[model samples]
Target: MDKLEAKNRIAELVQLLNKYGHEYYVLDQPSVPDAEYDQKMQELQRLEAKFPALVSTASPTQRVGGEPLDKFQKVEHHVPMLSLGNAFNEADLRAFDRRVTQLAAEPVVYICELKIDGLAIALTYENGTFVRGSTRGDGRVGEDITSNLRTIRSIPLTIQEKRSIEVRGEAFMPHHSFLALNKGREEKGEMVFANPRNAAAGSLRQLDPKVAASRNLDIFLFGYGKWEADSLPSHSERLKYLAALGFKINPEWKRCTTIDEVIEYVSYWSTERPNLSYEIDGIVIKVDDLQQQEKLGFTAKNPRWAIAYKFPATEAVTKLRTIELSVGRTGVVTPTAILDPVQIAGSTVQRASLHNEDLIKEMDIRIGDTVVLKKAGDIIPKVVRVIEEKRTGDEVEFSMPKQCPSCNSELAHLEDEVALRCLNPNCPAQLKEGLIHFVSRDAMNIDGLGEKVIEQLFQAKLIKTIADLYRLKKEELLKLDRMGEKSVQNILNAIEASKSNSLEKLLFGLGIRHIGAKAAQTLAAHFHTMDELCEATYEDFIAIDEIGEKMADSIVQFFSEEKVIELLQHLSTMDVNMTYLGPTQSQMTAIFSNQTIVLTGKMESFTRSEAKKLVEANGGSVTSSVSKNTDIVIAGEAAGSKYKKAQELNIPIWDEQKFKEAIES
Candidate 1:
């Protein structure tokens, strides 16, 4: 075939493959065999190879395309996609009901639906055509994944309504599909996906849209990201609207008038969940009324209008073969229960964390005892309960060791805390863990230094302390496997670049016990330099609001350590910047102090983000859309529904030029 004809043929085949994929994955139905799909894909690959320039990211053959990304980019969410508060039992459900009644007063109804075990995504449509989709990254933001989402068969490429809307939902791989895929992988000697949720997440993260398409993914629309237009009256009505507009809504949804009804729905699903084609961990209960939802509002990281009623803990009985202890970087000894291989929550379970000595003692867990294990939140397997009747007399009870497992240092127990800790300054395990934490993304954000790389570096004896990482040479790095000259240079460059990071990064990088990123930032902003921070007394640190006595003591104790002092000196010698950037010593200034502004639609003159920056620069806070609280709403051309919402809210609205003029004025 000629170049043009081959391109046309490839497009046709991609459409055919996508259709088959949708049928197989989304609908749980197949129109063609795997052999047929593979045949078409291979044919497309051949054409693409022959005409390399014609190769596109959306091509069917390009799923799982390119190498794995070094890092996921930060995407600020258009509207904060807050998580739902969890309701563990009927009492919790009743408490939620009480809270809703206190807030809404009059008769209230709840939208009860199956809580799908999958990755959450936000889908944005413009002029009834799907344009963008993103992962619920940090709730405030998510990764842009428009291409990957387009591959899902259940996600309509175009809606009949010619209006913009943002819909949020769970993208899932059904249990049956997951099993079939895993079976195929097992036959091919490839690594099987741990669970359906994992399979869906991994598939969606693929860089190539074609690879994502091949995975036969599906979605069930649940909520709106930022609703455009006010046509839908209630939450239930919106779901119906989405369904009418060609989006798939889970059929298991129900409208519950009382907490008892919600509990009934949850209980029914707890047993029925296992028998379903797709995996559902719990039932999601949300307020059905849109106006009530608005009045109910949200908390810091969760919505007050909705809550997830999780099913009773799913547990699998497994034999505890042995007990082992691992000494962490902080010299905390955590006992692990080595178990006979079993499956629980869709993954093979071999070991479970015993957490600390108290947990082991509380449960009286012994080697050779039959224990019930579970994976909570789909990660971290833990022993839930012991089947004492199943335990043989030969079972051996374990005790917490007096000495550190790694360095043989004496362990010490603290007040209020359960875990015994090794306070030894020279503990090797603590040093290694400290090094790992120091180089972690939220700390120094040094690229190419993951857990595996840290382990290898420690084993190679190239890094003895956090300071040793700064001293690593490019030539030495090149000696490691998979480390080409370019890779080596990248690592070296990243390490060098880390030296110039903000004081907050360095403060967090120090890995002081009980001090998190936010605490570190606050401390750094309070003290201009590391030297000032180190010299500050516990009382001085505690004087700051939010810096409690415990945190102050931890900070004082950490800075007072001779080894930490030496480490800091070494870092200083390595030419690390230890000073402030944003506000200097003299400035008693607060820039961008509270003024409310709302942003709407696409802008031609300036990007939405850029406009927000301009607003912040002149002391104004830019919100997602308009409301009564909005001091001003910056509306660009084709602002659509948010523009209308602004009008309804009676918020002051301005065009792009007027917004610019106002900012300057």
Candidate 2:
């Protein structure tokens, strides 16, 4: 076919496939058979190949084409995705209804939706085209998962409405998908996911979109976010509008005029949830009227107009086979229960947390005794209590090990602490755990060096410290299992790249006693050099915001250690960058210095990270949201919401050309 003919045919096929896909994946109704669908999809792919320019991201064949990302880029949400206060019992629901009545001041109408047990994701569409998708990381920021989300058939690539909108939803793995995935994993000798929620989350977080596509995940658009105009009076109507826009929303939602009706819906779902193909942990009750919801407003963490009525936690009685103790990075010895196989929350419960010696003693949990296990909201099951009535005389009492399990060093319990800790810094268990943390995403972000590889390297005695990772030779790596020449080279490159990372990453990766990622960032931003930070006294650390007396002491103690000082010297000698590379206002560039700038859309010359770094390196604060406070908005090709917001707010605007010129000047 000619280009024009191919274009028209492609459009027709897209419409047919979208319709068929919506029916099959969202509505659970199939109009076309698998063979027919496959034939049409093949035709579309061939046509697109012939007319390469016609290949759109929204095209059916383009759903899963992308390189496996080294890491996900963090995207800050203009609006925060907040959590909900949970109502466990009928009394909590009643109390929630009473609070809504008192606060809303208007007659309350409620919209109830099944709280799908899965990962919450936000999808952003610009002029009806799906542009971005992200996990609700800390609500303020999230990891970009657009490629993975595109593979989901239920999520439309484009809508009829030509408006920029942000949709929030729960991405879930259905029962059949979960079972099939686990079975496949078992056959491959890979550890199977404990629950459908975990499977869904794991799929979404996969670096490769093809892997996510194979998982067959689905989504239910629950609400809207960051939309400029939403004139629908009630949330129920908004849901209808979203459905009209070709977005998949849960069909089981109901509008309740009274709390009694809401309660009925919750009660109905509590028992009936088991019958559904997908998993749901609770019922979300929200005030139907948008205006009323606004009037009721939100608290610090959750909305006052909404509450989640959690189904009572699933519990099962199982025999406590034995308690297993594991050492952690911090040297804290944790106790886990190895239980007799019993089904709880639709998963086989073979392992549960015993939570240290105090908890075991407190519950009087003896081995071979019947124990009640509680699985709450798909979280790891915990040993709730021992069934004393069912206990036999032959049951064995468990005791905590007095010595470090790995090194045989004597374990010491610090005063005011319940759990025993292994103080040996050189303990193999501690080093392994610390190495894992050192290479984690939030830390040094060394790709290819994952937990399994770290364990292997540790066991091989090739790496005992974080610095040893930098010293990894390509030759030595080739000797390891599954380490091909290409993979080893990639790992070496990643290790090399991590050297230039901002000091905050190195600080967090160091596994200091009380220094977390945020605290590390604060410290790095303040001192700007590792040597300076090392010189910081307890008083100096205490003066910083968010650093408490305990953290300050910990920092001082950590830096004072001779081993830590030597480690720093070794890393520096290996050419690892120790100076903070992030922006400081005292730096040059009058245009960007101290300015809060927003960047939007695609840049031909620079990646988002490259642009962000340059802007930061020039002493500008690169913000995600555009508002009256924004000093400038750098509009790249096809700039979207932030550009429009900047225009609306009359903020100073810069095209990519102007931005480049300014930075160069």
Candidate 3:
């Protein structure tokens, strides 16, 4: 074939291969045989090799994987990926429904979806082409894992529409994939992962994308983060739109008009969760109408419009071998139950959290006694209760230590908290834990500075304070065991890169008591500079929304410390960035300012999200429902109940063309 013909054939093969792969992986229906798919893929690869410049990023051959990354870069989310509050039982779900009704002041419609037991990820598309994919780290910032995400055949490399958008989803491993992976690991005599969720997370985090590709991973797009198009007011409509755009959305989502239907959905899913090919820890219930979600807003950590109804945890019996104590960064002494290895759920259970001494006494959990263990949220393992009937008289009672295990400092029990705390600020254990937090992904984001590396540096006395990290030399890092020249350089480079991070990162890394990541972002944005933040009083902090009295006091108290002041000075000398660089909220002033508009039916000229954006750009808000307060309702072809309601309320209505002209004019 000629060069041009080869290019054309490559394109055809790429499309065919992608279609066949998607059909098999996502639709679970293969129209073409595997041999035909393989033949096309092989042809595409050969053509791409002959004409390297013609190879596209979206080509099916590219999914084989690329060179390993030294580290994943941090990506800032345009829209915060908020977590959901939990509902343990029927009462909790009912309470959630009541709260939604009271807030919305209308009968609520809900969309119930299986809360996939997997890693939460955000995929960004620019002009229909996948640009980036990231882990949902602390909501605001995430680790860029685009290479790994590309390997998932179900995830489209390009969409049907050419638009900029961000979609959120759960990337998971199927039960079969998990079993096969673990069986392979067992045969290879390697450590097996605990569950499908863990296996998926671990696979996605691989430095090499080829490793991730080998592990069969799939994704179910749940919602959009940002859709730069016309708006769809209902959540269900959005799902349909995403599917139309060539995204794989979970088909199990159901729209329920009332709380009773939601409850029924939840109850049915609770029993059916295990029967599915993939794991589902809970059912997510969300208000179907986008307007209700907007009106409900969000709490500090979660959305008020949605709640997750968690299934009861899977349980297993095991013998408690011993009790171990560990100190946290806050100096809280926590008890951990060391158990005789037993398989529970999908993984082996060797240890479970005891929570505190009070819990130990309440449960009468003695060492050498048989105990029932369960995973809380299918992630954290905890002792449910002691299997008293199975226990013998030889069981030994456990006790909480009076002193800190690591620092030998006297432990103090606070009146308000259950866990005993080590009040010594100079404790080595606290410093180590603080260092670990400082270099964490959401904090300083210093890649290659994991817990093991941090522990090694601390033990070697190469690093004493957070500021000491900036003073480390390449030679010093080389002294550590297993530290290669390349690894040391990477660590040094990460430390240097972290210096340019926004003030929020530094604030969170400081390990300030009562100040979480979100609060740090709020404070950073408000103050703009660390110097301004340091000078702010308790009143200044309290004035900010979401900054409570305790957090305010902690901020003021943290800044007041001489050591903290010294640390800040040293960091400033190192030329670390102290200002916020994220997008700031700007005031809107336009023709549609403060107007409540409702769009209904089909638009010939613009997509739903596009129309919504046009209205918002002109300073108007688009709502899902037609209410008495609605100022204008845009009716398109086959306008439905919203159109009739707007007419009854004597609200102004505009056709699709008229609406377009108004926005344009």
Candidate 4:
């Protein structure tokens, strides 16, 4: 094609790509299949290559992420991304209504939107073309992530109108996408990001927008950052204008004239949130009129014009009856508390993790001790406490096993540690546990090989170790209980597929004590080859950042064992990707830096680990109590005494939404 024709095609493709991106990313729906999108993108790239002058940096083809950035360039938000105040329940919501009514010159209307559980970012469009994007750093200066931001198919590469607009929205990895990404990362030995929020932030912060582009990150525009074109009088009207500008605005937002309607919207989503592919912590309530918002003005951090009504947490109580100890693949004993059958949130609960022996002693828990059980965020189950009043003299104190329960090997405890480990590499418990970890969703991610299948294999003597899994015969698998030819083939395919997994995943799958997915990635990157890592000393391993002394020692000791060396050889013959999987580092450090957080009660928005991950991503610490040292206590429903403790201590307490905003900030 001629230069003029190429230029025109590039512009047209850019516009079309932006439209498709909006339909897919902004909306929870997609109009075109991925193949169709890629076809058009490739055509645009080819045309641009033929005519370099036509390749404007803003073109859709320019969105492929790049190399590691030294640092993210700071961008001052044209309009500050103001924080929202919070209301815990319908009562507090009505109180907010009462307060707003008292302060208002007239009856006010409210607009409510689902508060998305994701990273907050500011998008800038100059002369109708998307230019830069940044995190909501301190609500003012944020790191520039323009290239990575453009990879979000929903983020309009260029606005239809020639107005300079700053848009405020959420950059989130959808739950489904998060699961898939984590699964893929796990197989490669990369550290799986703790939650979608961390995944999204880590993806966007990549200096190479190409990496971000591949992550399938998405965004939803919630409010106008700063706009000066044709003036919009109300917040609700601006939302409509944004939708008209080909920007994706949340479809669930409602213009509620009464407090009852607001309540209805909040109620609908509290139960409905689970059905969505992404996560929302609460609902955002804003005055419909921008003029009213101006009048309401601000507090120290939050906007008076807006308040977030949080959903009640999904938690229920069950009695802890007994504590059972299970040996991990690394032979570390982890305590699992058996509970009286009870319904919690949406599932049946019979067990909760007691974490370790120290935790059991710290909680002063014993068998026959009635304890409160909690599934924080409706995902992980944990024993909250021992009901000391119900304790009988028959109550038994729990102890860590002195030997491997499966193989009768002697157990040892490292100095200054709580985990009791069985050092025998050939321990049956360790083999079974290691195989489980190896095929875990965060590791090899073989779909059909769950615990039951593994147990059956163990019983049949078909697999003794993780490497044995790679050598399973189809005929043998089909002979097992509930195994069909189709199922056996599928399992075989998955096992074969796992051979391509990166090195870090294999390290984590090895079940070395204290070596989590993150630590695995750190070790893989630092050592590059499995052979090199196995030879490293504790001091050498400890030199890596975030690698604590205990973890370093665990790695060194794991490698020193002859049985482990044999296992590594078997895995090497299988051809796994034994290196870093994605961009090795992030531009934005953990957001919740140095602040301790305690999440109590039922968290409606995110699970306990998911919440902890959010805190960790933002440079904050997550703890288990309300203390003067605690920065924020994220209190949820049926909070019991922790809420009272937080209030009593005057610790900065945040309901779900406030906590979300605190992390985003």
RMSD to the hidden true structure, all candidates:
9.5, 9.7, 12.3, 13.0
lDDT for position 251 in model 1: 82
Angstrom error of the Cα, residue 485, model 3: value is 7.9
Task: Kindly give the number of clashing pairs for every candidate.
Answer: 4, 0, 8, 24
lDDT of 2 by residue, 36-137 (tens): 999999998888888889887778777899889988999988888877766778888888888899887667989999999899999999998999999987
lDDT of 3 by residue, 114-215 (tens): 999899999999998999999987566789999999999999998888899999999999988998998999887566888888899999999999999999
| Alpha carbon lDDT at 500, candidate 4 | 76
Q: Between candidates 3 and 4, which one is better according to TM-score?
A: 4
Clashing pairs in 2: none
lDDT of 2 at 314: 82
Residue 649 lDDT in candidate 2: 90
Return the lDDT, model 2, position 545: 61
lDDT for model 1, please.
0.79
Model 2 weakest lDDT span, ten residues long: 636-645
- Specify the poorest-scoring 10-residue window by lDDT in model 1: 583-592
Task: Work out how many backbone clashes candidate 2 has.
Answer: 0
> Which residue ranges in model 3 land beyond 4 Å of their true spot?
179-195, 298-302, 312-314, 318-346, 351-370, 376-383, 386-665
**For model 3, how many clashes?**
8
lDDT of 4 at 175: 72
Highest TM-score against the true fold, candidate:
2
Each prediction's whole-model lDDT (CA): 0.79, 0.86, 0.86, 0.77
- Using lDDT, rank the candidates from best to worst: 2, 3, 1, 4
For candidate 4, lDDT tens digit of each residue in 99-192?
A: 7877776899999999987788988888888878888765656788887887787877777788898889998887778878878987875556
Worst 10 residues of 3 by lDDT: 582-591
